[model samples]
Target: METSDLAALTDRARRLGADGRRRVLGIAGAPGAGKSTLAARITEGLQGRAVLVPMDGFHLAGAELERLGRADRKGAPDTFDAAGYVALLRRLRHPEGQEPVYAPAFDRALEEPVAGSVRVPADVPLVVTEGNYLLLDEGPWAPVRGLLDEAWFLDADPGLRVSRLVERHVRFGKPRPYAERWVAGSDERNARLVERHRARADLVVRLG
Candidate 1:
């Protein structure tokens, strides 16, 4: 992405919250497609008008995943608390009081979610949430799209995406060989599933 593109996106995001009536902007994309990067940039551009509430915070605990026998496929759609995420979005959409709403954050180093790591002020006008399954239409995920005032789907070169995933895994303590295998298997599968919902986005951003 170029500087000008980010400026334009920032300007656009600014307008989404201009009315001061809380708006939820969602960023959805396959792993390594830059959803979080873009979301954080857009939020930063808003200059305190927005708060980021990532979907990764809803990820099931490692213990829960192990008990459910889904530990082997950690990034799958079912491994997250989809309903809980949706509920939080709804709360953000219509905040009832002055108290800031607390949100969970994913701790990459620990590979788990830390509760109350994010505080969303009730008065903030925009909430930017990003994740892999925001655009998914199955089960509890179906309501996610409707809750968003606008959604952007990010796209990038497949090879680059996979390479980024591998690097990220390795950075987080996975051996390079094991990272490659996980990206090729579990992560790639989730990426394909995410691709199916590209057409549902309000905008499709192709990252350079």
Candidate 2:
């Protein structure tokens, strides 16, 4: 992520948002491949012209996951409200009225989705969304790719990505050993799924 590359990406985003309608730029990557970081950087670079709408915000609540027996595979594609996410994306594409549209946000500390936590003003031109499944083409997630004006897939060394995932889990309150196990199990599976769809993206970003 050099300064030059960041500047170019920001400039590209600005151009995409220049059209009359809102433009969506999606950042897709495997777990710990730095999707969120890149999305944040783009938003910051755009100043007030862009707003972030993370896909993680649409994660099924822990209680709902437990009820569906999906608590163990929390980060899996099936564990999200895919339809709801798609609906939100549609609303963002065709904003109604003059009011800002509110989107959900995920709270890492509480491990829950907070409703209406992010507001995307109608006047904002660019909406940056990052997630593991943005490029996924199966089931309900299929519509996601069509909605985005541009999609970027982040590529990183597998070992470094796993290491980052382990650290992230630990930072979020999981015991070190448990985090390692989760990374090896659930996270690894999700990572593979995300990688499988890398070719579908408009661009592949090397995040070494």
Q: Using alpha carbons, what is the TM-score of model 1?
A: 0.97
> Which candidate ranks first by TM-score, i.e. highest?
1
After superposing candidate 2 on the true structure, give the runs of residues whose Cα lies further than 4 Å from its correct spot. Answer: 1-4
Maximum-lDDT candidate: 1
Clashing pairs in 1: none
Error in Å for residue 136 of model 1: 0.9
Off by over 4 Å in 1: 1-4
Residue-by-residue lDDT tens digits, candidate 2, 25-117: 999999999889989999999989999999999999999999999999999999999999999999998898899999999999999999999
User: TM-scores of all models?
Assistant: 0.97, 0.96
Query: Which 10 consecutive positions of candidate 1 have the poorest summed lDDT?
Result: 1-10
Per-residue lDDT for 1-208 in model 1, tens only? 2232778888888899998999999999999998899999889988899999999999999999999999999989999999999999999999998999999999999999999999999899999999999898889999999999999898888999999999999999999999999999999999999999988898888767
Clashes of each: 0, 0
